[model samples]
Every structure is written in structure tokens, then in C-alpha cells.
Target: MLFSFEFSPIAVATLTFLLAGFVKGVIGLGLPTVAMGLLSTVMAPAQAASLLIVPSFVTNVWQLATGPRFGALARRLWPMMAGVVVGTLAGTGFMQGSHAGQAAIALGVALMAYAVLGLTAMRFAVPPRAERWLGPVIGAVTGLMTAATGVFVIPAVPYLGALGLPKDELIQALGLSFTVSTVALAAALAGGGSFETGTAGASALALAPALIGMSVGGWMRGRVSERMFRRCFFLGLLALGAHLASRALI
Candidate 1:
């Protein structure tokens, strides 16, 4: 069993990453969201988060480095990143304590909220004046959520979209945000004593199929209808989230 879990299926992991990576390749994100949602079915959220660390970090770093305005974006978003770190570290007890089972419920709720937001195509704009103060708050909240559920795509993603950046810069900004979240999450897990060797190795092993799936999905990107694909993806998340929450209750 992986990570000493009673029911860790290697095949399930292989297929989950493959599918998650395909979705990310088709879109620009969703790797962690998809992975955590699927993996938590057979294992704990903490275990699933452990498997998520390497791939999420690697992919986000790649996305972060591909941009041209790293200095500018870093300067603009540093406060948010700092807040993320603080929030994640501060909330580590949630994972390290007796609340492990409840984390699944939180993950479910997060996925459901995120899916609903995506499905509705809701848009918000953040004025430059408000960003100076709003960013850190958003980041901290995102980090706390990350620590609690290992999913970091709530307020942060929405906040980034509101920045009115050009498409490329926006993509880069998301990369930066996600990269920080991944690192902060890693720190939180490590502090909680959950980021062990076996977890790291399993996470690393999952990377190959994820990358392969991403390659295939990237090749098919223009051929398929992205709008339709996204709908299906969110719908799946909605269902998965419901299942997770309900299962936790049971």
C-alpha cells in the first residue's frame, strides 16, 4: 500500500494522473484540483496531497518560468505570496491534528465552489487601487484553504483573473500564484510530518503519466471544443465533490 494507506491502488493513481494531466493540457490548469478530487476517493486528503506536491510544483514552475515579466509580476504579487505562506503555516494544525477526516469534507466543498464558479463563468474586476490591500487577504485565505484541503484554486484564481492582465501575463500570473501555493502547501505538509520519502517517490512516479497525458492533450487542443471540454470537466468536479462530501458524512 502506498504511504501505508489501506487502499492505495497503483492503477487508480496511474489513470487519475493521466486524466488529470490531460485536462490540464487541454486547459491551462486543474491538475491539483482534479488529482485531489479523484485521489481522495481511495485515500486520505493528506495522502493525496502528498502525491500532488511534485507534479504540481514542477508544472507550475514550468508555467512560471515561461513568462517574460517575472520581476514585475513578482513585485506585484509578493505580498500575496507572503500571506499565502503565513496562512498555510499558521493553519497546519488542521492537517496535523485529529481533523484529518474532516479535511475531505472541506476538499469537497472547495471543489464544488470552484466548479460552480467555473461553470457559471462569473467574472469580477479588481481595480488597481484595491489590489494593494486586497491581495494579501485573498492570498491568506487561499493559503488557509490550501492547508485545510490541499486545493488552492479558489479566491486566488478568481483574484488573478480580475487583474485585467493580458492573456499571456494572466497565464504567467496564474503560474506564479499556483507555484507559490504549491510551495506553501509543501511547507505545511512537511511541517505536519506528512511529506515523507514514500510520498515523494510516489508523487514523482506519477509525473510521467501526467506529462504523457498532457502531451497528448496538448496535441489535441485545437482540434476539440475547449468550451465544451471545460463544461464537462466542471460537471465532473461537481459530481465528484458531491460524492466526496456525502461519503465523508456517511
Candidate 2:
């Protein structure tokens, strides 16, 4: 068994996964953001990140399979994939660097920045000519951020948004991107010896709650106001970021 109700860690991890999945169901993203942010409050950052691997991977794979198509998006985003691997590996080396606290603060800043971007009515356009250069750069930084704080939605999502694809295509691309990010994270954890079969087992078991919460959120999405839900999500993220930043900096 993963844990008994008597253990607070199990309860916290389960709730965090459920909440993250719900957000993803409603908004089509933010699972990692929610999971990482909430879990970080209760455990070491790397351990929290390790816990996210199975659930994120499973959910994103489901998203990708349900989408219209795939290989093309994966090919297009290859640079981002490469960057994620490299950046994550490099960032893992600094798990106990003197700047660890600073890295955590950067994570909080990244989250708040993403929240602000979501709240505003701004979108960037990276002309195809520029995307060739920008895609990998954004991916690498996202990987770095993921390694440091377990969050991976900053520049990647915004960058993907700028592509100006059809709604379905954008969603598909996000699934690919997130899947790559999750894999890279898992690899980094394995490389650092922070992830093991036992951890993987716990993460797999957590998938039940995550999937269930996603179904509920999916049902609620049709009944709720997406615009309002988005605003609330960003606001909640802002508050969480503030808390994380304060904890790290204080």
C-alpha cells in the first residue's frame, strides 16, 4: 500500500495530485504547476518532483492519444525536447549549490510571471524564422526551471501559444511538450539517484486519484465559466508563488 490515512504525507500527496489533475482537466494544463507548487510545501523539492513523474506522464500521454494527431508536433518540438534533457541534467548538478535558495526564489518568480502573463491580454508571435532559434532556448530554460522547482510551464506554454495554431493543434503540442518535460524530469531524477522503483510505485498508485479528479474537473468544465476559472487559477498560482518565494527567501 502507498500509505495509510494515518500518514500525513500520503494524504498531502494524494490531495495534491487530485487538485493538480482537476486543474488540468478544466484548463487543459497546469498539472505540474499545481503538483510541484503544492508538494514542495510538504517535502524536499526533488522528492516532490519525483512523485509527479508517473501521474504527469500518464495524463499527458492520455491527452496526446486523444488528440487529432502527433508525430508532426513531436518532430517540430524536437529542439525543445533536446533542450529539456540537457538543461535538466545540468540543473540537477546544483541540487545543493550555494545558490539553491536563489534557484527556489527564481521558481516563485517564474510562477508569478506566468500567472501575470495569463491574466493579461498579451501574446507573442515568433515568426517561423525566429522559432528555429527560440524553441530550444525556451525549452532549455523550462527544463532548468523544472529541475530547480518542478514547474515547467513558463516560456514553454507561452512560446507554444505564440505559434498561433488551431485550438486542437495547440492542445496537442502542449501534450507533447509536457510529456517530453515529464520524461526529462524523470531521467534527471534517475540520474541523480533521487528516484527509485519504490518512488515510482507510489507515483503510479497516486494516478488513481489524479485520473478521478480529472474526470470530475472535466465534468465541471462544461458547467463552469472557463474564463472565470482561468482568472481564479492564475490568482491562486500567484498566491502560491508568493508563499513559496517567502518561504525560500525568508
Candidate 3:
């Protein structure tokens, strides 16, 4: 694994990761949504996903492991985790062909639509009985996207947020979701022969800036109002989605 001391790409990747962390720290979700969208503009979608795995894992682990509500989050989110695992496996295997760029674009557009609907104040009610299916459905989406593009978790977060859980619990749930999906994705990539030793090393090097960004963002989380953070986060997502859509179309 040769570490390219070429500072330019590293610098850009670091900055992007930091910004993504800032958004996640503020809004309780969206590290992959932001990071992958931006990184994909410069790096290949698979490369962007690989670069982000370590940082996302580290930061989410910090959030989940340190939180008092970890146990409750685990209990509540097991179904979603299972779904994420399944979806990730499916995505990694079937979605990893050379034609995946088109799929990434499609996924990005779908995410944009979801963001737009949220901006429009869309509403839906899950029947008490149907709620049992939510986790698996979301997990499946997250996993597939994690393997194919890395922004698939956006559709699930809003529904999870609407559940009206405590803030800490929500963060822990997000952490758990990210962690589980990332692990599954790593396994899938290995199984599919998509894991590259050089890329993984580069990704590890890029993790430093992402960690720095997470620290800064976590600090800001304490200072900013949740409403303001959420507003900014969604707006960022809108911009990211639009950018990706255009990239896909061009």
C-alpha cells in the first residue's frame, strides 16, 4: 500500500470528510450522504465509498459507544440493522458491475426526490402493525446503497427522525446503522473481489481529516440550535443531490 504524499487529493478528501462530519455532528445523520456526494464528483463512487468507511465507522462508534442510551438504541434498531445487512449484501454483489455509475446517478436522483418531498412537508402514517417492517425496509435500502453508492441512508433517516425518539437515542441508532452497514459492506466488497489494498490504505490516510472534522462538528453541535443545524443540513443535502443529478445526466 503506497501512500501517495501528493497533498492535493488528500487535502480535498480531508476537507470533504470534515464537512460531512460537521453536517452529521449537527444533524444526527448524513455523513455518507454529504461525503459521498462531494467525493464522487472528484473520485470514483467506489473510491469515495471506500475512503469514507473508516471515518464513518470511527465517528459513529464514538457516538454509540459513549452514549448512555446505547442499549436502548441497539434493542430498537436491530431490525433495521438486519435489513441493512441484507440490502448491503445484495447491493455489493449485484450492483458492483462496471455499469454502476449509472446506478449511482439513479440513486442520487431518488435521494434528491426524497429530500424535496421532506422540504415540501410530506407526511405519512405507518400503521402500528406495519411499523415492524420499517427497519428491514430501511436497512435493505441502506445496505444496497452502501454497496453501490453510499447515499442510500437518506430515505430512512427522516422516518426514523419522525419516530419521536430522544436525541441521544436517535444518534445512537444512526451510529448503529452506519456501523452495521459499513461492516457488511466491507464483507461484501471482499467477497465480490472489489476490495483493493491500495485504495484501502489511501482511505485510512484520509481518515485523519475526517476525525478532525468530527471533533470540530461535535463541538459545534453543543453550540448550535438543533433547528438551525437541521435546516442547514437539509439544504446541504439538496445542493449535493442536485450536483449529483447533474453529474449523472452530463
Candidate 4:
């Protein structure tokens, strides 16, 4: 059976990926974030999550490998990665079956919070000494957030942003974190029987448009003002979040 909402699922997925990919191409992040925010409107968050896995994972891996100090970054972030996995697995029960609506609500709240933070341009400074203990905790919380929502950029993104890494390092760190989150989410879904062969195939099919969008976005990077684009992106997220939250409630 075809997955149909008001529109054809294939059309929705293709257009969503194209736009989400474009956004990511223009910015360094947001493929999963954008995709989840949009796709969740037409389908359950769990279903949206399954469709996003392949594109998110592949894009994040590409992002993770692009910059330097890969080994050092991985070593530094392993604890947090482990924490993410643990938290995600622990929280996976809340995302399946009858709890999906609650998960959608959680996703909405997370998106709203992220949008507010981005719009405010708030910055935090985490002392280097604090990272050893804080990273895992942050990871755990982020993982929980991921399990509850299909999105994973809550405190994790903010915390990483606070670390004060250089530009390249920061982007790499995001890729690393997102990559782990993707793998963990996939595992949790598979364990719960949400990510089967059909979902995997759909996810794989979504990858092409995503890549195409990314290519266009990358090309547009030089021409577009990042600050302007980010502002627009956050605004879109804010509206989308509101709609999802309200829709879930009603």
C-alpha cells in the first residue's frame, strides 16, 4: 500500500529532502532536523525517523570525514557517544506503539526550544575542565531527547557550540555527534521493530534527492548570506514546531 496523506508520500519525501538537503548544503547541519520537522507533519514521528535514517547517516558520515583531526575528535567524544547509545536504548520504549503521539509532542517542544536558542544567538562557554564530566551527561540527555523525538539537536548542539572549538573542529564535532545519534536511533528502532526492510528501502530512496539538494546548497553557499539563511531556517522550524504541537494536542 502506498503511504498517502493529503499528498503522495513519494512526492512529499522527495520535496522534503530536496528542501532539507538544500538547507544542509547551505548550512553545515539541519538535514535531519529539517526533514524530521517537515515529515512528522504528514506521518508519525517514528515513521519519519525511519525514513530519515539513511540520508541522515550518509550525510553525517560525509560531514564527519570532511575535516581534520578525526582520530582526536573521536577519542575525545567516545564517552558522550556511548552515553547517547545508552540513553537512546533506555528511552526507546517511549517512542513505540501507543506512545507515538507523546513523542510527537516532545519533538515539537524540542524544535521550539532549538529555534528560540538559535534566534537568540545565545552563546555559552564551557570550561575545558568541565567537559570530562559534562560531555557524557549532555550526551545522555541528548539521547533521551532523540528517543522521545526523531530530532537530536537539543542540549547537545548547544553544549557542543559552547565548547569553543575552532570552526572546522566544531563542525566535525557536530558530524560526529549526529552520526552516533543516527546509529543509535537506528538501533533503537530496529530493536523495537520499527525499522524493517521496507523502511530501510524508503530511507535509502530518500538519499538521492538529499544529495542533490546538498550539492545545490553547497553551490549556493558562496552566494547566500549564512546569517540570513539561518534566521529563515529557525523561523521555519518555529512555525513547524507550533503546528506539530498543536496538531498532536488536537
Candidate 5:
């Protein structure tokens, strides 16, 4: 049977990658964050995740590698990374059944959480001692949340942002975290037999649009104040999340 989904799966996937890529180019993150969130509006979480696997992994790897401190960050953040891996695998199990409504709701929750954090302008720092204990816990939650919703920001992004790392260090750290979660999510989905040849092929093709969009967004980045764009982005997320949440609940 053909892989059935809403909104012309290819059309949805293509636009999603393009838009998500542009956002990443502009903001330096959100390939999966934007892809999964918007795609979830029209497809199941599992399929959205599968579509996400390739583009997210490749870009984030680039994001991590170019940062000049992967080794140090890896050494420092290993516990959280490990926890993300484990948590992603565990939560991905729920996706094995691939419940669309549940997946939609989970995505909605993740989107809302991200938007709320982004809009609030609330920022704080975790003391180093507390990070030792809190990092892994936060990672686990982020992993589980990503697995369920296909949106990996939520507490993870907020928590990481709160850690008071220098600007470059924070970017690398996020890339590291996103890389781990993407790999783990891929593993879980593959293990569950979610990818057929057609779906996998389409996912591979999505990288094209994603990369193109990223390039455009990248070009626009230095030309604009991302602060205003980010606010608009989160507001959009808030609206999309509310729509999804309502779909799930009502």
C-alpha cells in the first residue's frame, strides 16, 4: 500500500524542509524543531520524525564540528548526552504504534513550551554544582519529549540556554545535544521498522530543499536583526501549537 498521509506528503515535506532550513540559517537551529512541528500538523509523528532524520543529523553534525570545542563540550556534557540517548530511545517506543492524535498533541505541547520560553525573555543560570546533577535529568526529559513529539527543544533548549555558557560555546553545546537526540531518534525509528523504501527515499530528497532554505536564511542572517524575527517565529509557533493542541483535545 502507498504511504498514506495528509496534505500531499511530498508537498508538505518539501515546504517544511525549505522553511526549516531557512530558519536554521537565520537562527542557527531548528531544522528538526521547525520541521517536525509544522509537519506534525499534517502527518504522523513517526513519519515526520523519519523525514527529519537526515537533514537534522547532517546540519547539526556540521554545527557541532565547526564549533572548535566538540571534544571539550563532549567531555563536559557526556552525562546529559547519554541521558538524551537513553531517553530518546525509551520515548521513541511510544511512536512504534504511531498514534497520530497523540503525536499531534505531543508536538503541540513541545511547540507551546518552546514559544513560551522564547517569548518570556526569562533567563537564568544554573550553578555549576547543580548542573552536575541537573544536566542528565534535563537530558532525559528532553530525550523522552523529543521521542514522543519529534520536537526536541522544550526543556532541553531552555535548560541549555540557562547554563551561562559563552555565545559560541552555547551554540556548539546545542548542536551537540541536537546531534545526539537526532541519532537516537533515528535508531529508535529504524528499530521499529518505520521506514519503507519510498518514505526513506523521500526523506533523503528532502535534504535538498532543507539545505537550499538554510543557505537563503544564512544569507539573510547578517543583513537583519534576528531578534525581531525570532519573536515573530515564536509567535507563529504559539499559534501553530494552539491549533494542534485544539485538534488533539477538541
Candidate 6:
């Protein structure tokens, strides 16, 4: 597909990435949700996912390198990376033959479900034994969805949240997870006959706006209460979910 941007779509996409990144910066999550939801309105889910790859990589690199708890991050990295690789392979395989619209709808529903779960007052703990296994499961699922849709990270976030990890640790984990998944996804795309030069250029073009958003959102993280941030995030997910679901059904 030709990706030459007329001014209007470029402006909209730029704003969307900015907002998505801002949310991610503050909360240490939600960038894919924000970007995929908004971008899907204008671009195919595959296209949107591709656009996010570079920016997510850049931000996560910064977060993992400079964020606190590098030691813990190092310890957990291997298992999570394994999950990301496995998941990406699965998702990429699925996407190679699947319909993009179907993938978008599925991703949308997953995001909405996650948002609803977050909004719930009920909280539960995962046993340590369970967590070891659960990490890969979530990672695989995230990778698959990420390969299929732009918003694959949703499945892992709540699980991490429920682990009662410190805020900084959770952020680090997410950055690491995204990095691994994106790499795997990129490899899959290269092999799947879907990765094209034009698409990659478009993705690179979109990265700047996404980075801008992340910067803004990171700044807002300190200003908001946890409760407020969670609430806003939930609402955004719900809205995005509704839009994707609607698109699929229509």
C-alpha cells in the first residue's frame, strides 16, 4: 500500500501517537492500546502495529537502560524474552493467513477485557510457582497478538499489575517485554512476505510523534494519583475496545 500522507491523516496520526506515548510514559504502560485504537481508525491494524515497532523499541531501550531495578530486570529478562519470541512466532504464523480485520477485532476485545478487569475492585494474587509458568504464557499470547494486531501487550499488563510489583519494576518489565516481542515480530514480518520497504518507511515516519507522546505522558505520571491514572486508562481502553468491536461488526 502506498503510504504517502496527506496532511490530515498525518496530523491525526501524530496527535494519536503523542497522546498514546504520553499515557505510556506516565503509567509505564498503555502505549499500544492508545496507538492501536486511534490508528486503527485510519490505518490497517498491521500497518499501525508496524508503525509502533520502532518507537516502542526506542522508548523501551531508554526505560530498561535508565530505569531503576536493572538487577531484577536482568534476572527476569530471559524467561520473558523466551515468551515474547514464542508468542511472536505464533502470532506471526496466524497473521500470515488471517484477516487483518479479524485480528483487529480480537485485539480490541482483549484490550477491553483487560480494561474491565483493571476497573474491578477484586484483586487476586498469583502463586510464585504459577508466576513462573504464567509469564511465558502471557508473553506468548502477547507476542501472537502483537504480531496479529498492534495492541498485543494488553494481556500481560494486568497480570503484571496483579503481581503487585513496584511501579518502577512493572514499567521495566513492560519495556523489556515490548522490546523482545517487537524484535520477534520484526523477524516474523521479514519472513512472512508482509514486511515491505514502503510500510517500514511509514512506520519510521510515525515514530517521532509516538516518542513525543511518550515524553509528555511520562511527565504526567508524577502529577496524577494512581487511582486517577488507572481510571483514565480503563476508560481509554473501553473506548478503544468499543471502536474496534464496532469496526469488526460493521
Q: lDDT values of the candidates? A: 0.88, 0.83, 0.71, 0.89, 0.84, 0.74
Clashes of each: 0, 0, 4, 0, 0, 8
Tens-digit lDDT track of model 5 for 34-140: 89878877766788888888888888888888887888888989999988998988875665474667778878877888888889988978888998889899999
The digit string of per-residue lDDT tens for model 2 on 17-41 reads 8998999999899988888788777
Q: Which sections of candidate 4 miss by over 4 Å?
A: 1-7
Candidate 2: count of backbone clashes, pairs at least 3 residues apart or interchain: 0
TM-scores of all models?
Answer: 0.96, 0.93, 0.85, 0.97, 0.94, 0.88
Off by over 4 Å in 5: 1-7
Write model 4 residue lDDT over 17-82, tens digit each, in one string: 999999989988899889998888778788899899999999999999997888998898888888
Task: Report how far residue 149 has shifted in candidate 5, in Å.
Answer: 0.4
lDDT of 1 by residue, 1-250 (tens): 5465434577788888999889888888999999999999987788888899988888888888988899999999998989888888888857545787789899999999999999999999999999889999999999999999998898899999999999889889999989988988888888888887777898899899888878888888999999999999999999999999999899
lDDT by residue (tens digit), candidate 3, 1-250: 3234367767778789888877766666667777877777776666677777677777778777866787767777788888888888877654356655675685577567666765766655555566578768877877776777666575566666667667777767767777887778777766776557876777677677777777787788779897776766667667777877777778
- Regarding TM-score, does 2 or 4 come out ahead? 4
Q: Judging by lDDT against the true structure, name the best candidate.
A: 4
- Order of candidates by lDDT, top first? 4, 1, 5, 2, 6, 3
TM-score quality measure for candidate 3: 0.85
The number of the candidate with the highest TM-score is 4
* Residue 243 in candidate 1, Cα distance off native in Å: 0.6
| Residue pairs with backbone overlap in model 5 | none
Count of backbone collisions within predicted model 1:
0
TM-score, ranked from best to worst: 4, 1, 5, 2, 6, 3
Q: How do the residues 32-148 of candidate 6 rate in per-residue lDDT, one tens digit apiece?
A: 778778877787666667677777777778877766887777586567568878878766644445587687787788778878887885576766777778877777777777777
Task: Give model 6's TM-score versus the native structure.
Answer: 0.88
